[model samples]
Target: MNSPGTVHDWVFDAIGTRWTVTTPSPLSRPVLDEVRAEIDRIDLAWSRFRDDSTVAEMARAAGRYPIEESDQPLVDWYRRLYSLTRGAVSPLVGQTLADAGYDADYSLRPAPQVSGVPAWDEVIAGHDGTLELREAALLDVGAAGKGFAADRVAEIVARVTDDFVVDAGGDMVVSPRTRPLRVALEHPMDPTKAIGVVTLDGGAICASASNRRVWADWHHIVDPRTASPVREVLATWVIAPSAMEADGLATALFFTPAAFLRGDFDHHAQGFHHVTIRRNGSVEHTAIPGLELFL
Candidate 1:
């Protein structure tokens, strides 16, 4: 539903999710066209649900695959996430997810004998402009792809207006003009309730929750080490300079501790801030400038 409110909000569907773009004024036709093209490019390169996507091609063949320069940054970020999470988050887990019934068809029926994910070093090697897959392996980039697309759209919007908000699903990038944007953090167990609120001056915020996608006894967040769903964390939210980083960190917090990530990113000028809710109902959050929790 595209509506023109006081802020000029446009909502649409893309990449298997909804998106909303808000600007000081209406977006130009050229900007919208470019945004759509960029989204299509991202979906073609990273979507595992499509048969003709680049990831699907890698799943069918094992060899050196060339990729666009624009795609290289995401590959690098995935490598960083893999190392930071100690292999808990891996692109090679696509087959494991499919075997557990989260395949392209969304079968939701686990295979009788699910296979373990191959080691990162064993399955693939990264090089400039290309990746060498040792064997056929399905790669899933859903973790950060949506956020990257959001950032890309924000870049397009910035070309026209300096102040805008690009929201791809729940991953958002904000460029405020004067005051900060107030964001409600939705409760993991109940969408109608808000657990907290954030005052985002600028940059990006992303969230991940186990309760968002579930079927039977399983959820979308699977532990690659055991080839099963993770039950430790209920939800996580991250605020960073980039939506891609925020999105990846939101998932990484599920597999790793916040302290480790905090220590690593502390060197930055405005380091990332995060909020975590464990399955035991305990909440952990950093004392940052923009976060406020009801509990």
Candidate 2:
């Protein structure tokens, strides 16, 4: 795993997630500490796991008062995700999660009796960054948190070095120098096998599969449209200009129609060069148009 003096790798837990950072230059310990702090800050601002997180605070404050502008980024992010996915991906899925047995924390407790969540459109945004919900809604950004954190960490690392990669679970943001970054897609049913490999010149790559992070026979990804699990595809990988886009799109593609994905998915595939793996271990991948020059 060593890449001479041009690469350094570090791993730690933050934002209720484990993150791995690989960069060109050997960053100072203090710099890595600061990056970890930034990851924590992003999580506290958006995590559903933390009671004091901005999302939880808004959930608690819903109907009592208007949510402040401090949570604007999350609001905007959700709005975009909802719009892009045709409402397949939603922050309002918190209620569905609770109904299915998820509680305030990840202790795997029984689901408490709860009411149904209202429509995603019920969450209204003010001119400023304020948010107003017609009813109390549980907001969860588990779909986007890791990719967002990886993007932020990559930005911080970019300041110190020109080449790097940040992987939060399977989501990654790479800044390559000497060689194209190569990533293998682990089989959902069998981790010992890889469906295929993808080489990235630079940018972000994120994969969402039904097999990862399950609870009580239920997968983490819930279709906001039906408030049920996405069953069409076993796994999807997306590569985009930014980590947030790649992360959110991967989640969205899991529930999107195969027809709707033909052009759009191929666009990103050609743009950033992505590889996808299905449950049956089929490989769907495309190389960037001119990336062979860089490789």
Candidate 3:
């Protein structure tokens, strides 16, 4: 039984970041390890840096892969983001990130590079659940994959207990679907300070920053159109119904202006709450009615 007072924690390193899982009840070490293994398996499917990952294999052959129902959610989210951001947030920027010296090893090395993203619109999806990429492009799921993993972490915890927090780096998913969690937004310009904190009433919260993974003028996040770094925002945070959406929207906010993300540009999807840090350390946040962000 879980109460408000109990917090069981597990920490581990994977996919270049530390992941923390806080459960209200004892989610035993074996169970947590199995969750970790599941994450490891998912990484082999989504990692851009791994030479043997499914994404890499697809890039190698520029061919089709069996897309099961499990991958449907990510595909749907990626497609929606790709359209909303007008291709700024893409699923085919693997080569661009690699050429900028952020390849699998993540050594933060610098190389003179000309980067480009493939035409994801030209990608083929079959009725039998297969996705084919016929270009010289790689897939970099980045924190979107992490976000998906975090969601899975929450799902595993929810099966046993209702109270849990799965923080995969900055992409987090909190269980019970209604408990509010206070999260501090990391300041991008200054490493030691927080820009703000918001109460995540439910669902997931994800934060992304280009400066976190940069070498020289190149960072992990690039503008799909120009094949260069996005200059508008230093960092972004987004909260949505799922960690995957929050993570993808956080990346989109980096390239998307704060104006459009506000005022109901689209109504079919869940509403998104956002906070953006600009280049000069100035911050702006948008709230949807009941949501409040404290600076």
Candidate 4:
């Protein structure tokens, strides 16, 4: 259901992705300004592109000492991602990326060098908010940044209205609305066609597609176990109670084996739902028992 007043739409760029916020009610100009300011604050703190960002500063300060406790979210996210990927996704992949010709920055005059795959265990986080690395390690948060941004913006929007959605790239956080929110999953190989639509109610939805970051047949979603691109799953969607979970799970599912994509996955994740699109274009969905499917 729509709100009683006019629907307002706002768009801005943050965390290297486009962010959109939609509300069903006519918000006062001052309120809208405050919301935008909050979004900017989040980007400044969390953006990996900014050299002064908390993540970048922490990465630079690695091996020197642990950062402050206020930087706990970055540490917490690293721990969660490590557990979720079984150490398959780590900030330690900085060396792998450097060897793949992405050193320093992904711009003109980039450095090219061969470096060994850094191990996750070498990168340690202390309870006092300090991060240490046994060896030189490069941390990349490309996989989780959008989700983090979505989650942050969602919290801000929730303060103003009950019905709102924050879409950062393909990850989204949707609050309770008058009706179910419909989300369309794009085909991995063909952006024009949607493979399916999922009806979301007061949860977050995130989709990861394999074709977006391909380079010479190699993609960004690397399998840390093999230090290679994940080839089996073309796309994965995860629905969870929060955008950060959904975002991390979607990336982790790309590295999950096809056998695990079957019914048994639900046993591991209690309330989460999954949709996997195979390389052959076939779709498989598994959710908790009795869950409805819009596709």
Candidate 5:
């Protein structure tokens, strides 16, 4: 459902998830189709499930390989995130996750216990667009790819209309012209009930939860150091200038505490705001002057 000032919403499927675009007015079918294609491009490049994707190819190589210039943005972002989190959220955790039977199939069946995960330092990234992997590790971009795609979709939407909300699954880039968009944070433990409702005007919002993609004791987001599922925080919401940053920050908050996030994520200049809901149903949030969290 749209909030006050929106005209209608367009819903479809992409990137292995549903995508909806809420706008003040309906967009042309051609523009909508273009948006779909753009999102699909991101999936084709980063999806680990696909046999031909760049990420899958990198995983298969397990050795020194040159990355495409087009993929440099993703590599740079990951490197920054790795440094910021102090390896709490590493791209190398993908191998550990796959070894633990959390492969693209999504069977969620428990696999043999993983011993340890590789470090981001081991995978040498060069400024010349080359990535040399010292050992084998799957590079998972699931953390920020969808949100990045959402931003790209929003960019496309902005071309036609100034007011729109591009939601790629739970990662959203909302640009509201008339009024604020009402966004509800679903209970991480119980999806049926919402924990809070917040207003999003002209920024991106992404939520990371341990329960959304869980089966057994394992979930989608895995800590690189421990090679285990995150448990302390049930969910985290991040609002940032771009959906890509917001999405990665949401996952990073799972592994790293919120207090340390400001400095690590350059929250000052970027105007980053976060809300964390722990396993005990407690909340910790940065005090944004006008934003209200209705719990």
Candidate 6:
């Protein structure tokens, strides 16, 4: 599957992010169409910005809402992350983000005083193939939804070719191949400069940064405890077996220490690594096999 000399690529926008798909040969039209549909399905289920989205319905009123069976796993993963991070990373952060100005209209203006985000246990629960909400609460899966979508698209691409890479924004899933691919680790403050590089044969890599979306002394990565932007960690990148896992872990690293993740986060069984940049101008990384840093 290592036909490095011949590469076929497709680039487009999906789920509010840029995406690219590369393979040894061009995929069939049907396969490409399936990939697009798969992504759209995910957006429809999870997007908070859309009035007709399932999440928006949850936000508007409390009730038992049924979702597609495929979407249950994503909701379960968010539940796991909420428990693992002790509520630091939560789908309940949707209201927190909007109050801080990452709203549906892209309004970056902070409310005078933001309201507190609800706890997962108190607000939401799963009941007989449906999500039961105790009250109207905005849910946000931006932490890992894109990665989950990427993994789903890769599944479609995998049917056509074993050799491919699906990149959704910075979250990527690379199929196994004889030769490795080199990826640059972009600097949080300067996109033109890279803090490091990674040579990868297969698997997924996802990044999260405080620099991507910014407002008045606030950023997208918020601390649910305070409903304020996180200031300690500037950015993080994670590598794991699945893009969903990698993406969630990238955001988790911002709230928890690397040492804690290495010991407790179950991605250890499947193997994972990370690189972190702190707000105080310090850098840290695990002993990742193919990582090289110039910092």
lDDT of 5: 0.78
Q: Give the better candidate number (2 or 3) by TM-score.
A: 3
Candidate 2, residues 1-295: lDDT per residue as tens digits? 4566655678777765577887655678888888978876777766777788766777776543344453355457767767766887777888678667665655554355434445665664441445666655677877776777788788788888787788887789988545677777776777787766667778888888888767775677887766667666788777787777777777876776444544544444344344555555465555543322211
lDDT of 6 by residue, 1-295 (tens): 5365788889999888899999888888899899888888888888999999989999999999997887777788888888778898899999888988899998999999898887887998664478899999999999988889999998899988898999988899999977888989999999889999997789999999999998898899988988888889999999988999889989998998767666655655524788999999898887776799988
What would you estimate as the lDDT of candidate 1? 0.87
Model-by-model lDDT, in order?
A: 0.87, 0.69, 0.75, 0.68, 0.78, 0.87
Report the number of clashing residue pairs per model.
0, 1, 0, 4, 0, 0
Task: Give me the runs in candidate 4 sitting further than 4 Å from their true place.
Answer: 1-5, 26-48, 54-61, 64-74, 102-104, 107-114, 125-128, 257-270, 288-295
Candidate 3 total steric clashes: 0
Taking the tens digit of each residue's C-alpha lDDT, what string does model 1 give over 146-246? 88889889988998988789988889999964688899898999999999999888999999999987887888888889999899999999999899999
**Candidates 2 and 6, the one with greater TM-score:** 6
What's the lDDT for residue 170 in model 3? 78
Clash pairs for candidate 5: none
Residue pairs clashing in model 6 are: none
Residue 271, model 3: lDDT of: 52
Candidate 2 ranges with C-alpha deviation above 4 Å: 1-6, 63-74, 109-115, 258-284, 287-295
Worst 10 contiguous positions by lDDT, candidate 6: 262-271
lDDT of 2: 0.69
On the 0 to 100 scale, the lDDT of residue 67 in model 1 is 78
lDDT of 2 at 226: 68
Cα RMSDs of all predictions? 2.4, 4.3, 2.9, 4.0, 3.0, 2.0
TM-score of 2: 0.83
